[model samples]
Target chain A: MIGEMILRNVFHRPVRTAISVIAVGVEVMLVILVVGLTSGLLHETAKRVEGVGADLMLQPPSASVFMAFSGAPMPIKIREKLEEMKYVRAVAPVLLQFNASGGLDIVYGIEQETFKAVSGGFVFHEGGELSAPNDILVDDWYAKAKQVKVGQTLRMLDNDFHVAGIVEHGKGARLFVPIQTLQELSGARDKASVFFIKLTRPEHTAAVADELRKVFPRYEIRPLKDFLSLMTSSNLPGLETFINSMIALAVSIGFLVIFLSMYTIIIERTREIGVLKSLGASKGFIVRALLSETAVICGIGIVLGIGMTFGMRAVLTRVFPTLTILVTVDWVLRATLIAVVGGLVGASYPAWLASRKDPIEALSYE
Target chain B: MQNAATILAPAIEGFLPGEWDVDLILKTDNLWKVYRSGKLEVSALRGVNFEVLPGEFVAVMGPSGCGKSSLLYVIGGLAQATRGHVLVDGNDMMALSDAARTKLRRHKVGFVFQRFNLLPTLDAYGNIAIAQHIHGNGFDPHRFEVVTSMLKLTDRLHHKPSELSGGEQQRVAIARAIINEPKILLADEPTGNLDTKNSEIVLGMLRQLNRDLGQTIVMITHNPEAAAYAGRVVHMRDGVIVDGVPED
Candidate 1:
């Protein structure tokens, strides 16, 4: 009955109801979009790092320090030294650098045969495998941003290289090059920037890191998961702060809009409220009726907002290609919980006003 | 002999005492209602003593600002009197908790507003059914038919308040009021919003409800013609009862 009454009243004032619904929907959509973009960035960055299947990365102490803000150089020989250990299954050497566009990029020096093992069987758009020493594989994002195609030669760090293939991975920007070619181009003798180590299994990875810290006291042996988290969080604090602030702002707006809408509705229907009151409706009943109206309005807005999120995903992707806005089940759950809380918060003020209305005063109001 | 006594009792005596006797359904002693706005305190009801009996139709008549509606609101438990005591169905309103007073108002007293305060969202039947529902009682559909038919609303059960005429809406309000079988029915100018035709229709139904169903009704009205329909009339001025004609 409360639902029916709310539905009827909602339609009775179509213009006001629509405005209120749109206001709520816009706020909800903003929150969903911001959260989706932020989490997508984090997930994509992690995916790119996970693509290598390296249990841990060994970098020069200062190399780990500047890895987030800017690329730093480590000796090219760290990979060879780590590979000699019996516990180390394989060591994929990598050199870190940045393009002229200021986008940080990884230059991996992967063995022709062993590159397949470290690539985690990732699909390449053009090339079947990493074969030529001077050929480079670039991610679609980097390739598109640079406007480079297969067989296009580009000079980096005084060495010219050919774009052999285009690679696509979840949300990560990467460019792969052969080990000898990266080593020769960078002009670093017997020195590798970073060592990507694949341990025997999950259990041996932690032990290997512990063992590496003891053996090579000068380098930082960071597990893939922890390293990426620290790097991303440290690198993107501004975006994270902005998203957090936006969430609070959106929720506040949702509460205010919903509350005012319900308040106006209750005030306009004073006679109806009195009738309900005089009909033996407890204060609890009155409060529930008003809140149910709020929930219904907000629920409709949220459903529309969710639909809008999906419909606009393509546009969002086009706007920021690096962002992987994957609408996972968890995100949907979070949005639902946030929306429900927002609806409840919005209804609280109006419910109080409704419960406090004197049936006589209300009956007399209109 | 019994039929003769029963007929004579109501015509001459104030009321017959029975299990459903209306006498003392509501009692107020020296009730006062003072409104304080900033520094000025105006008295709306100044020590008015009143009693409404069961199975009696009483109209409270007074000019504007004569405290007629204030007295009704006080007696109906909708407002708290500034001073003095109000007792409804043996419950002292001043002493009862807010929740208890709310319950007393809910289960015991029925209210009809001058505006025909029917829920606009509900149809006539829906409005009537809500009373029982709010009181946590299962709706007795049979009683719905009896009350609605008594008010001449049998044909307009499904019509919302906006769709119905003022008279029909007032009738639905009355049906909703009496659906719970409340001990007292308080109508504040139930015909105030109706035209002569609709007013007559509503007043006629209220009179019939009192005479046939033995329901107690207390109406606040300023119109002499509307007040004349009641079996007894009470006049108020400055929040005190100026005159009251006994039922005899």
Candidate 2:
């Protein structure tokens, strides 16, 4: 009977109920989208890096694993010394330049033969790779997103480069240029940003990585296979704080919305509460009714928020094809739990007030 | 003083000493309810003594500010007396805690209000059933139907209060009040918000419940015509009963 009364009361004020539900939904959606976008970007970037088929990455001392943040600081001559190591098949000394022309992208500068040996080589859809100083190979996703053609002239980094080919994506970057051109353009002549080392056998990865780590103890020598697992918000500086701040913002929105909604509803229903008390409703019963009403609203809001999140993911990916949004079950459940707890906590004070209201006074409330 | 209730308490002149250990269902001894505002104290019930036998239908009549409603509230356990005792069916209402008073209201006392205070969100049936549920017991479908049938509200059971006529809403309130079969039903101007025609219908239902179900009732009213329906009338002036003897 109390359940029925609660549901009926919730439905009694449609506009108020909808406003509360949508507020909570927006809160959940915000938290979910923030977490999803960050996790998706990190996971996608890590997967792309692993797709290079490198057994190890050798960077300059104290260089970050985030390729875009690392600069072309290592000497290109170090590739030969790395190539001299046991079980090392090839070492691709690549220059990385951050480009913000039409969009954000990492421009990879590579020597064709060694890069091909390290990555199994690009699977071309049209044209050919790295045949000229200004020939640029574009991946399919970037090609489609930017509408680049095989014979088109593409300008990046204030330099005009003819499109050499459009290849399959998932090779660490969307655009590739000759190593010497990027090194000269960036004024870091004969210096590579990082080294991608191919091994003769897959099992030799640990042994070679251990050997490299000991030789250059200060350098960031990382096995490519283990890189993705280490790429998380906790492993990245400031990322965890960014996510926590977003969650706090969402929780605050939920709390304030539920608080105002429940407070107003209780005041509006003061006489109704008095009627319930006159009917012998206990304080616990009134408290339970108010909190249950909040829980129901939050539950509906959570489902709506999850649906809205998926809809947004689709719209975002469609608008920006390069963008990836991964909606994980873990985060969805966490957001739902957070919204429920926030709503219940927000309603607690109003529930207590309702319970403590004098029945005669409440009955006489206008 | 003819009986122990009077002999044991000859202080109450109105009682004239009732018979024996008191077959009375309700008794208030020197009840006093004072409303204090800052440095002033205005008394609503001043040394009022009252008694009601089981199955009695009594109407309390008074002018405005005569403390009729306040007396009903105190006797119904909705409020506490300033300094006195209210015993309902041998249980001391003034001595019970807030929770115990609430429990008493749930199981022993039921109330009908002037405004027909049914929850607008619930239907007539829901309003009536909720009381039984609040009594912390299982629902009795037979009693529910019987109460509705007694009030001629069977057809209007599914209607919300807004959809029901004024008389129908009052009938629903009465059904809810007696749905749990409480020991006493306190009606505070139950028809004060109704039209003359609706008032007659609601008053008729109350009399029928009192006569047919033998339900003990204490009703507060100002209209002499409304009080005429009760078996006995107790008139009050300035918070004290001016006429205690039954003139019916």
Candidate 3:
């Protein structure tokens, strides 16, 4: 019966209820989408890195696990030394340059045979591998994104290169060129950013990484199998704080909306509160009824927000195919918890006011 | 007749030690209710002594602002008296905490207002059933059927207040007041908004509730015809009862 009254009161003022619900929905959507975008990109990027068929990645001294952020400080001869290591089967030296022409992307400069040895070669969709000094290989997603064709000239890093081939995605980077060609183009003549080492067997990755770490303790030696686990917002600098700030902002939106809605309800229903008190309702009962009403509103908002999240995800991913927005179960639960708690807290003061209203005065309230 | 336990429990728990008065259902001693705004003092009730015996239906009649409503509120524990003692079912309302007073109101007192005071959002059944719910008493189907049937509202239980006539809304309010079996029913002009016929019908029901069920009642009103429904009338003038409760 109390539940029925709550529902009635919720719908009694439709416009206010809708505005509050939409506000809460927007808060939940914001929290979910903000957390989803960053985590999805990081996880997807890590998966693509692990998909490169390398068992171990060796970077320059004090280099970041994110090889894109690390410069080409290591000499290209480090690949030869890594190739001669115990249990090392193949090594590919890659020079990376950050490209910002159309969008943010890492350009990989690689030697054809050694890159093929480490990555099991690309599945070309249009043309073959890089052969000329100005030739470049683009992946299917990147080709579709930038509208690149097989024989068209693509200008990047202030250098025009022939579009040699279009390969399947999920290799390390979208755009691939010869290492020595990119080395000259970027003014780092004998430099490579990182080495991708393919071990002789799967189980020898830990031992090989440990041995390499001892030889060069300052260098970053990361096993590819553990890359996905390390790709979290907390592992990256300032990213977790950014996500928390967004969540706090979302919570504030939910709080203020719920506060105003419940306060308005209290004022609008002042006479009704008197009736409730005259009916012998305790303060706890009144508080519970108001809070329960807020919970129902928040519940509807959360469902709508989650639906909007998936709807927006579909629209966004379709329009931007290369962009990945993942809505995980963990983030969805966290958003729900956050919205509900925020809404309850926002309604507390109003509930207290309602419970404390003088019965005679409230009955006499116009 | 009330159940044996209902009759016996109040005897045991409804009084401070050695202060029990079994003959009186409600009583007030020098009830003074003063409403002060800054330095301007307005006395709503001043040294007014009133009493109601068990199973008595008493009416408090006065013009507007004469403190009849203030007396009702004071006795029902709905407001604190500036200086007075209100005893309901042998329990002093002045000394109890807010929670205790609320509990007393829940179990021992019920109220009906001039405007019906029915929650507009709820239907007749919900309005009636809510009283038991608020009193923390479990639903009693037999009592519900009996009361709704007595009011001739068994079929109209699903109608909202807007759908019901003025008399029907008042009947629903009356049903809500009695469903919890409160020790006393306090009403402030239960028929003020009704037409002549509806007022007659509602007053008839209140008399029926008092005569047939032996329910104690204290009704506040200005109309002499409305006060005539009660077995006795107590007239108030200028915050004091000019003519007190009549001899049974």
Candidate 4:
């Protein structure tokens, strides 16, 4: 009966209830979207790094392990030294650059034969692999997004390059061109961004990385798996803090909205609370009623938030085909828990205030 | 009848140890209440002694601000007396903790307000059921139906308070007050907000419940006509009892 009263009370004032639900819903949506987007980015980065199929990555000591933002250049001489090592079978030097369009597109300059030897050969969706000096291979999603077809000329760094083929999704960077041509165009004659090293024996990866690290003390050399772990484990500067800040922002929004709404409700229902007290309602009863009402509202808002997340994800994917959004069950549960807890915390103060009101004074209140 | 163990066990075990005067179900010795605001003080009740026997219907009559309502509130354990003793069912209310007093109120006393005090969100049935819920006795469907039928609210149980007429709302309030079968029902101007016809209807229902069920009632009203339903009337003036005789 008390539960029914609580339900009715929530719906009794439709406008107030709607505002509270929408406010909580929007906060939950932001939590899921922001956290989900961050997770998607990490997942995609790891998959691409693994797809390179290299035993180790060697970069300048100051370069970031994150492939997309890695900018410090290493001497191309390092690739030759790595190939001369006993266990190293092949070494590919890559020049990485962020596109002018907000760094969403990654350009990789690679030697065709050495790249294919260090990493598995790409699977082309259309046309053949890299053959001409100005030929470039782009990922299928990026090709479609940028409308780059085979035989079409695409410009990068003030130079025109012919689209040679479209690689399968997640195969490589969004754009790939000849290393020498890119080096000349970018005015870096003997510099490469990073070196991908392949080992003859898979079990020798750790030993090879340790040896390379000692040989080039000014460079960073790590097994591919280790680098991926570092990226996902939040060891990258500002990533964990950024995600934590987003979560805090989302929870704050939910907390303030529920607090204000429930506070106003308690004020408006002062007489009703007095009546309940007069009818022998214990303080526990009043608190339970208020919290139950808040829980139901938060539950509804969470459901709406989850629905909105998937709907927004569908729309975003259609608009930006290359954008990946992973809505995992874990994230959904986390968002739901956050919203409910925020709501309960928000309503707690108001519930306590209502319970502590003097019955006679409240009853006489106009 | 409705599992006495569930309804009476807590009340019996937690009841305060005091002088057990079986005949006097409610008593107040020199009950005093003073209102304080900043540096000013106004006394609402002054050295008033009162008593109500079991199964008695007593009406307290007074003009506005005569402490009639304050006496009811103190006796009902809803307010504290400045320097006095209030005994309900032989337990000293002033000596009990707030939670214990709340429990005693739930198990022994019920209140009906002048405003009819029905939760607007709940229908008539829900409002009545909630009383039993708060009393910690759980719901007894048969007793609920019996009370609703006695109050002539059987057909109107599905309607919310807003949808009910003033008389019907007061009747529902009355049913809620007694749904737990409390030993005493404290009503403060229950018909103050009703029209003449509705006031008569509500007063009649109170009289019927008192007579048929042997329910102890203490009602506060200014109208002598409303007092006629009670077995005794106590008149008050300037926070003190002016007349102690019961009109036959």
Candidate 5:
């Protein structure tokens, strides 16, 4: 009976109820989108790094393990010394550059023969692989987003290059060019950003890393697994804070909207509360009723939020193909839990106030 | 003074003593209620002793500001007396905690207000069933049928309060107050908002319920016609009982 009463009361003022529901839905949507995008970026980064098919990685002493932001370039001669060591099957040097389009595109420069030797060769979706110094290979997603086709001219870093081919999704950088040409364009000739070293046997990974560490004492030599772990860890500055702030903002918006809505409801129903008390309703009963109403609203909001998330993902994938959004069950559950908790917390004060009203005064209220 | 047969039978009384026998279901001894706002004190009830025996239909009559409503609220355990003793169903209200007092009200007392305070969102049946729900027992279909039939609300059960007439609404309120089978029914001007015809209808229903079910009732009203339905009427003036004097 109490539950039915609460449900009816929630619909007593339809406009106000709709507004509150929408507020919660919008907040839940924002939380899922922001968190989902971040997770997708991390997942894609890990996959791309693992696709290199290397057992060990070598970087300059001062360079960060995160390839996207690492700026310190190593001497290209380091690849020859690593290839000569025991248990080293092959070595490929890679030059990394941020494109002139506001750093949205990562440009990787690779020597065709050594890159194919150390890592598996790329699978082209449109045309043949890179053959000329000015030829570039783009990923499918980037190609769709940039609207560039094979045999078309593309511009990056204020230089024109011919589009040679389109790589399979999640294979490599969005834009790829010849190593010597990129080195000249970046003004760091014979300097590579990192080296990918393939081991002869799977068991030699740790020993090979130890050997390379001694060979280049001042450099950072790590097994591929440790390097990937470092890339995914919280070593990225401001990322943790950014995610935390997004969560906080989402919670605050949900909490305040529910608080204001429930508070206004209490004020409007002061007389009704008195009537309930007169009918022998305990304070606990009133609080439970109010909370149950809020939970119902939040439940609806969460469902709507999840629906909107899938809808937005579908639309985003079609419009901006390069953007990835990962909506896993765990993330959905987390968003629901946060929204419900925020709504309950917001309603607590109003429930308390309604429960504490004097029955006589409330009865007499106009 | 009239004997029990004259008073408890169908005879009318202008005044009665404030004391009763040990069979009392409700009693208040020297109950005092003081309202303070910024150092100004207003005493609503001043040393008022009252009692109602089991199955008695008693009426408390007073002018405005004579503490009739305050005394009813205190006896119903809805408000705390400033300094006094209130006993309902043989339990001392002052000795009980706030929560216990609430429990006492939930299980032992039912209230009907002058305004017919039915929940606007609920229909007549829902309003009546809520009292039983609050008492922790799901609705008793048998008792619901009995109460609705007795109050003549069988046909109007599904109508909301706004859709019902004033008298029908009050009947629903009466049905709600009695559905839980509380030990006592405390009504504050149950017919205060009705016309003469509806007032007579409601008063007749109250009288029939008392006579048929042996229900104990304490009603506060200013209209003598409303008080006439009770077996005895106690009149108050200036926060003190003026018409009723108990025999030692």
Candidate 6:
């Protein structure tokens, strides 16, 4: 019966079936997009934090914010004190200053070789590392925007530096410069600000951050994970509220759409349902058949939506090198569950209405 | 008439006489159905007393709105009669819950509708096969051959309802109705949708089902020609059974 309901009746009416498919598809797309974008944003921001490769952020006792806001910068002495701690694995210091060509941006500076381990791909796109004290390694996006390439000279801080290598980082905006070069050029007050520390283990991160904060009572110390959330939330307004509202809106709208579409289908198939009822089909049979159709359409929509997400991710990352969309298993599970619930919830009204129809009246219905 | 009634009454009540044809197959006594449309009480069946024995062929003839169909419905356990009792195969329909009525409908009664109401999605074979599947019984290949051939549906078994003629679809509907070998066959205007030629063909198959398989058939139709095919004809008007006549 499932096979017959799924393949024969569902596939027979290509138009209705297509409409069902589209309904399911839209539901799936909405769920996947919501989960994908939110999760992707979270992942991408976290990746950026990890790109700084910091276990904990140690800042100026009074002036430093634990989270890296757009303008606030830690002083150099804080880094010196943090490095002096025995638990600190290694300390890589960075100075950040803003540059705005179109929107807000950040220019980061760190020691050439240590910056390699700290910033990872923040220097050269390929093989070579950040070597010259006066040379800069910017993100590929910024390089293209500024049209600065290797051997080309760019000016900042009232000084010029060779474009060393276009690099990539998980956090912050686009620029990477040598620590000595940025200090001389940007004249950033007390240039050395951030200390990116690779922690000994998971248990040591909070302890180390707490110990660092105690020593620098004026500054806030935070684990990189917490710092990343702070950075992302500060950039977006009412982050939790916005996400909750969007999710609530999607779910409500999804239920309404699914309900109406499925209801219309049931109304259209009233005669067919009557025929089934008259044919000794139990109510359970009809219910199962309707649910089976809903499940199939929902499944189709989920697959299509997920596929679209991956496809869009490919295009997005290609077009905007800075936009990294990450899809995780949790996102897939969440999207699929939403699709199913939407389908089932959507199917509820129609199934009940169909079942409530009197077999004789439905048969007589033209 | 006496001979037909004698033959049919036994089939209607089987060998047992005292239990009101409960196990005999389809039975109803003092069944009253009142249709209330916002305080307008229209009595469709006023204490309809009726019975059809196993393998008996009966026809109901009546004018429009006479409630012949309602009688069939109440007996088939489709509609709940407002008062009195309905029993099929010795089971009290009114006393039993809705679920039990449905079970009786599934296992004991097979219905053929006026519209030749075959499920459009299923082909002729599928329509017949679905009954067997629903009953949790294996599809008998020999039974399939027998019924389809009897209905002259062998050539059309694979065709969908749209592809079949009205008569052919009705025949498939009949095939579906009897595919379960139900105790009682209730057909509502089985020939109403067919042309004369097709009507006769449907009537012919039904007659054969009655004669050979002893399948009890209660058909509701206004056509005199259709009524003539039945071994017994019951005339209905305003929900009352006016006459129970056995046709020779």
Q: How many steric overlaps does candidate 5 have? A: 0
Residue-level lDDT tens digits of model 4 in A1-366: 888899999999999998889878887888888877877877777678777888888888877777657665878987778888989999999988766843367788999999899888888899888888899998988877777799898877778889999898764577899998888877778889888888999899988878887899878787887755676627567878988898899899899999999999999999999998888788998999999999999998998889989999999888787787878898899999999999999999999999999999888878
Model 4, C-alpha of A356: deviation from truth (Å): 1.0
Residue pairs with colliding backbones in model 4 are: none
**Candidate 1 per-residue C-alpha lDDT over A112-131 given as tens digits, one digit per residue, 9 for 90 to 100:** 55545554655777654566
Off by over 4 Å in 5: A100-103, A225-233, B1-21, B245-248
Q: Write one digit per residue (lDDT tens) for candidate 5, span B1-248.
A: 33222112121122212323346677788989998999999999999888787788889999999999999998988889998788776576776777777888888888888999999999998999999999888989999999999999999999999999999999999999999898899999999999999999998998888899988999999999999999889999878777754443
The TM-scores, one per candidate, come to: 0.84, 0.94, 0.95, 0.94, 0.93, 0.83
Poorest 10 consecutive residues of model 1 chain B by lDDT? B1-10
The DockQ figures for the candidates are 0.52, 0.70, 0.77, 0.77, 0.70, 0.49
Q: Is candidate 2 or candidate 6 better by DockQ?
A: 2
Candidate 3 clashing pairs, residues 3+ apart or interchain = none
Give per-residue CA lDDT, model 6, range B1-248, as digits (tens): 22212222223221222344333566677889999999799999987777666778889999999998888888887788899887676667786566666667878889998888777888899988887777657678888898988888999988999999999899999999988888889999988878899999899999999999999999999999999999988988888888884333
Looking at model 5, the pairs that clash are none
Candidate 2 — which residues are off by over 4 angstroms? B1-22, B38-40, B245-248
lDDT of 1 by residue, B81-192 (tens): 8899887766667766566667777888888888887777778888888787776666888988899888888999989988999889999989989988888899999999
If both were scored by lDDT, which would come out higher, candidate 1 or candidate 2? Answer: 2
| Residue B188, model 6: Cα distance from true site in angstroms | 1.0
Report the lDDT tens digits of candidate 6 across residue range A181-229. 6776666656566667766665798788777767776665667767555
For model 2, residues A126-216, the per-residue Cα lDDT tens digits are 9987889999999999988889999999988999999999999999898999999998888999999889999999899999989998877
Q: Candidate 3 on B139-207: residue-level lDDT in tens?
A: 889999989988889989999999999999999999999998889999999988999999999999999
Poorest 10 consecutive residues by lDDT, candidate 5 chain B: B6-15
Q: Rank by lDDT, descending? A: 3, 2, 4, 5, 1, 6
Error of 1 at B4 (Å): 23
lDDT for each candidate structure: 0.75, 0.89, 0.89, 0.86, 0.85, 0.73
Docking class of 3: medium
